[model samples]
Each structure stands twice: as structure tokens, then as C-alpha cells.
Target: MNIIKVRITVSLIFEKIFGKLLKGHERSIQAKKNIALSFLFKGLSITINIILVPITISYINSNRYGVWLILSSIISWMNLFDVGLGNGLRNKLSQTHAFKQYSRSKVYISSTYAVLLIVSIGIYLLFFLVNQFVNWYAILNVSQASIYNLNEVILLFVGFFCLQFILQVINVVLTAVHATSKVSLISVISQITALIAIYILTLFTKDSLILLVVALSGIPLLVQLIATFWYFSKQYKHLAPSFQLISFSQAKGLLSVGGYFFLLQIGSLVLFETDNIVITQLFGPNEVTSFNIAYKLFSVLVNVFTIVITPFWSAFTDAYTLNDFQWIEKIFKKMYLYWIFTIAVAVILVMISPLLYRLWLGNLAINIPILLSIAMVLYVAGFCWLMIHCYLLNGIGKIRLQLMLYIISTLINIPLAIYLGKIWGTAGVTLSNVFVFLYMDILLFIQCKKILNRNATGIWNM
Candidate 1:
């Protein structure tokens, strides 16, 4: 009897192992398919931008390009208005969907859109006023000592740009609702239109620098806003703007979630862009150009990975809602390994980036390869951790924790980066990123482990 029982147990164990292997393989394949589609859109965008870099460089000088980079970076800081509401909405929607609370889900979704639109408009007006009054020429480090009257042009561009950003936020909300295919289509169309506008502007205009920047920045936002509103209006008739107000109580819920995210957003902007600002101040505008070039290249790699991982936010919500911890763990492990591999490849590409830059942009001032490699490694690791933590926290409706971690990391990063940059230059600034990410990742890991332990203990007792 003992011999028979042992043999049966071994057979059962083997069967279970085989079943798990098959399931894992299937899940990985599905994940890859999703990743591939996301990557296709991202890759196309990156390729187009890469091809344009040389064309733009040939037409406009490096100094103008550096200014454009600075202005764009400043505008990117406006993402603070997002305040994590998109992810918070997605989290709530996912949870609601899991619970079959469709009515509540719609209310949450509508209220989120309402709040973001109002906040976005306010932020835009604030920026507009600042741009109008601020003597950016005095503040900015441009190659030409004279401040070109770009404030009016930049303000106009940013105003339209803000509208576009609001539309994109709506698109993100749509994406959270599992409308990524539509989002991808809209993005491609908008980008193509914007590129064509830039090309035409470049061909005709004598003032290529200003014209190109305005066309590149302004047209797409306008096009995207139009397209997004049209699409969303058509599909979700209820999403139309109306006086159907969100109660203060509901507003408080969003603010509660978003407040933390706002800090995180601020911290993120400071952490990522502070180096360029410091380099611009300490070194010069030319160094900014070199750093921007390398940073742009690194950004492409990070964006590609982000596109792949983005859809998982909604999927994670679904899994969490179903009490599927095992599935979550499996996906997380796969993503971690994939990130390691992806970052390795990114580092290798960045190692050869200087050679590519020399061939493409002539002799740049900074060591492109080293800066690119270090920044690539730091950004990939840091961004990966940020994304993973955000998704995990969002799934659990723990936006505050995510915000706290980012705030702590950002606060630490600023002083550390400033100190390091003073000592080592751009490379030292890049190294500080590794430290920031390491701290956040360690904290997140500990927190996640504790959550898992409690969850597991509860399950075991049940």
C-alpha cells in the first residue's frame, strides 16, 4: 500500500508541474502578443523621430535645438496636473468592473475626466501667464546672448499643446477602459499629421528653428484634441461635456488619490530633468545639446518598454480583482526578468551611441557614448521600478504609498544629484539616478513582501 501511494503521489506531482508549465507558456505568449502590438506603435514613432533628428539637425543649428529641448522639458513638467488621477481612475474602474458595479465605474470615469479637464485648463492658464511675464531669455542659457522673442511663440504653442495634453489624458482614460487599439490608432494619425506639418513648415519657412518647433509642438496637439474628442463623443455619448456635476464628496475621493500622485509627478520631473537644468546652468548650452541628444536616444528605449508594459496596468487590475495573487506574482517575475534583459540590450546600444552620433551629428561636445550608456542604464532601471511599483500600487488602490516613495526618492535625488554633478559633471548626475531607484525599489520590495505575507497568511487560515 505504501509503495502504491508513493508512486501515485509522484505521478500527481509530475502532472501538476506539467500543467503549470503549460499555463505559464501560454500566459507568456499572450503577454508577448500584447507587448508586440504596443511595441509596434512605439517603434514606429521612435523610428520616425530618429529619422527626423538628422533632417532637423541639418536644417537648424545645435543651439536652437538646445533651446527647443529646454522649452520642451519645461513643458513636460506640466504633467504634474495629471496628479496620478488617470491611474487612480483606472484602478477604481478595474475594481468596479471586477465587482460588476458598472454604474459606479461610469461615475468614477466621468468624474475623473471632469476633474482632469478643469485642472488642465487652470494649469494651462497659469503657464500662459508665466510665459507672458517671465524674461526667459535672462533665465535661459542659449548660445546667442540675445533673448529672441520666443515667449509669445512659446506661449501660443504651449496653449494649444495643453489642449492636446488634455485630450491625451482622456485617451489614457480610454486606454484604462481597454481601448488601447483606438489610442494607438489615434496616436499614429496625430503623429503623422504633425510630422507632415513640420516637414512643410521646414520646406517653406526662412525662420526654420521657430517654425519647426511651433509646427512640431503645436500642430499635433491640436490634431489629437480634435480627433480624441470626436472619437470619444461618438463612442461614449455619455462622456460629452455637460453640467452634470461631480459632487464635492466624489471630488474629494479623486483628490485624496491624486494628491499623492501630484507630489510623485513633481518629484519625477525634478528627478529626471533637474540634471539638464543643472548642466545648462553650470556647464553651458552646448553641454545641454549633448546631454539632450543622448537623453533623447535613451528615452526612445525606455518609451518602447513602457509601451509594452502599459496595457498590463488594466490587466493587473483584473487579476487583482479576481484575487489572483499567483497570476500577479508570475507576471511580475516575468516582467522583472524581461526588464533585466531589455536594460542590458539598451546599455549595449548606448555604448555604440557616440559612434552613431559622430556619424550623424558631427563632433558633439560631450562624450555621447558614456553619457548615453549611464543614463540609459539608470533610466531603464529607475523607470522600470517606477512603472512596476505604480501598477502594483494602483492595483491595490494604494496611490499614497506610490506618491510617498516617489517624493522621498525625488527629495533625496535633488541634493545628491547636485552634489554629485558638482563633483563629476553629467556622469555624476546620471549616477545619482541609480541611488534614487535603488532606494525606492528596496522600500517597495519590502512593502510588497509584507503585503504578500499578510495575504498568504489570511488565505492559509481561510
Candidate 2:
């Protein structure tokens, strides 16, 4: 009787262990599938963008095109308003979803949407006020002949720009809700349509660059908003916000989270986008165009890696919420290896960047090999740091530390970039990024290690 009882107990234990292993295996497979799908969409979009950029640059002279790049960079800084709301909401949703807390998930989603909408309105107002006072013409270094035209068209462009920014927040909400495939599809189609429309419009209105840019840029957001509304209304009817004001408690949570994320965004923008401004201000708009072309081409590799990792963010959040330290560690190890491999390939490509640039743009203005190779290395390092930070800190709600690191880094980036740009020109500016990313990464890793260790201990105790 004792032997029979012992055998039965051991069998039950083995079965339970086997079941868990099976579930983990299944989850790993699902994670890979999701990552691949997300990567496919982003890869296609980037490929299309690459094919179109040369044509666009050719149509609009390099100087004028550089102005576009600078304007876009300025707009990229405006993403500070997103704070970290998308990430915060994603973490919350992943946790709630894991536990089958459907009602709470709906509330969280609605609250996040409401908060983002309010923040978007605030950003719109800020943009308007800045537009009214700021001398965009001087900043862009527009020729006297073009200055009057730029001033006349600035307000109209700002309006369209604000509309596009609001749509971006809505798109973020869609991403948090795991509706990214739909968003990605809409993004690609709308962008292709807009590109085609711009090409057609240019034939008739060759001189109306501002109007062309505004129309082409704004129309895509309108399409995205329509797609978002249609999909969310049908698929997530329960999460639909009534547009009523969110409670103070909910607002506070979003803002507190977003404020930190906002700082981080500003820091990252300072590190990445400030280079163009510094280069243009120190050298000229032509140099800006040269740098941007090389940077964008090299960024294809970085962006592909980002797209591959993004879908896994929600999964990391879910695992963190469950205190699954083993799974988290395993995932991190796999991702680290993959990132290292991807970056190695990017470095190799950088060796041929000069040839690639000549083929793409015809008689490059800059040393594409040096600029792209340095930028590629900096970007790859930054990408690795970002994945670890997002998985460990952002996934688990330790964003305040990230915010602190970003603030310190931003303070460093401004002076360093300006000083470097003055001394070495564009190369100096590009080289400074390596230092900035390294500083931030080291700080983040130290903090993350402490958090992971503590959590691992807790998991073991549990």
C-alpha cells in the first residue's frame, strides 16, 4: 500500500511539471509568430519608404529636402506628450488580460484613451502658441525669396501637423490593445496612397510645396483615424470611451507615468534629432541633407530589429506581472543574442555605405561610409539598451529611474553635441551619440540588475 501511494504521488508531480513545460513551449512559439508578423509589416513599410525617398529627394532639391527632415525632427520631439502612456497602458492591459480581468481591462483602456486625448489637446495648443511666435524661417535658414511663402503657409501646416499628432496617440491606443496588425496594414496602404497622391499632385502644382506636404501628410491620419474607429468599435466595444472626463485618480496615474516617459522621450530626441539641428546650424542645410540621407538608410537595420522586438513587449509585461522571472530571464538572453547578431550584420553593411549612398543618391555630399558606420554603431547600441530597458524597467513599472537617467543624459547631450559640432562638424555630432547611448545604457543596466535580482529572489520565495 505504501509503495502504491509513493508511485501515484511521483506521477502527479511529473505530470504537473510536464504540463508547465508544454505551456511555456507553446507561449514561446506564439511569441515568435507575433514578433515575425510585426516585423514583416514594418519591414515592408520601410522597404517601401526606402524606394520612395530617393525619388522624393530628387524631386525636391537636397536643401529643401533637408528642411523637411529638420521639420520632421522637430515634430519628433513633440512626441514627449505621449509620456509613457502607451507603455503604461500596455503593461496594465497585459497584466489584467493574463488574469482574465475583462472589466478592469476595459476600464484601464478607456481611461488611457481619455488621458491621451486630453494630453493631445494640450500639445495642439502648445504647437499653435509656438507657431505664432517662433521664427521658423530663420531656424530653417530659408532664402529671402522663400521666407515670405514659408511664413504665409506656416499656420496651415501647423493645423495639419496637430491633426496628425492627435492621430498618433489614437494609434498608440490601438497598439496597446494588441490591434497593431490592423494599424500596420492601414499605415502601409495610407502611406502608399499618400505617396502616389503627392506624385500626382506635384505634376499639377509644382510650386505649391507647402500645400502638397500638408495634404499628403494630413490625409494619411484621416485614413488611420477612420480605420481605428471602425476596428475598435466592432472588436472592443466594451473599451469604447464615452468621451466623458476621466476621474482625477485615473488622470493622475496616466500623467505621472506619462510625465516620466515624456522626459525620456525628450532625452532620446535630444540624443538623436539634435544632431541635424546642430549640423545645419554649424555647417549649413546641405550638410543636413547629406547626414539625414545616410542616417535614414542605415536606420533600416535598426528599425527592423525594433519591429521584431516590439510585439514581445506586451508579452514581457504579462510575464513580469505574473512574476515569472525564469521566463523573463530566458527571453532576455535570447533577445540579447539576436540583437548582437543583427548589429554585427549592420556593421558589415556600413563598410559599403559609401558605395550604396552613391548608387542611391548620385554623387554624395558626405563621406557616407564614415558617417553611416558611426551612426549605425551608435544606433545598434542604443537599440540594445532600449530593449533591455523596455523589458525590465518599463515592463515592470520602474520608469522613474529611466526618467532620471534620461534627464541627466539630455543635460549632457546638448552641450556635448554643440561643442562637438563646432569642433568636428557632422562627424563630431555623430560620434557624440556613441558616448550618450553608452552613458545611458550603463546607468540603466546597473539599476535593472538590482531590480531583476530582487524580483528573482521574491519569485523563488513564492
Model 1 Cα shift for residue 37 (angstroms): 1.7
Relative to the true structure, candidate 2 reaches a TM of: 0.85
Quote the lDDT for 108 in model 2: 63
Model 2 Cα RMSD, 1 decimal: 8.6
Q: State TM-scores per candidate.
A: 0.83, 0.85
| Candidate 2 per-residue C-alpha lDDT over 226-337 given as tens digits, one digit per residue, 9 for 90 to 100 | 8758766887666555555345476567666666666767777887788878877887777888777777777787777766566566666677777777777787777778
Question: Judged by lDDT against the true structure, how good is candidate 2?
Answer: 0.68
- Model 1 misses residue 360 by how many Å? 4.1
Q: Rate the local accuracy (lDDT) of all candidates.
A: 0.67, 0.68
Winner by TM-score = 2
Model 2 bad stretches (over 4 Å): 1-27, 125-130, 244-248, 363-372, 455-462
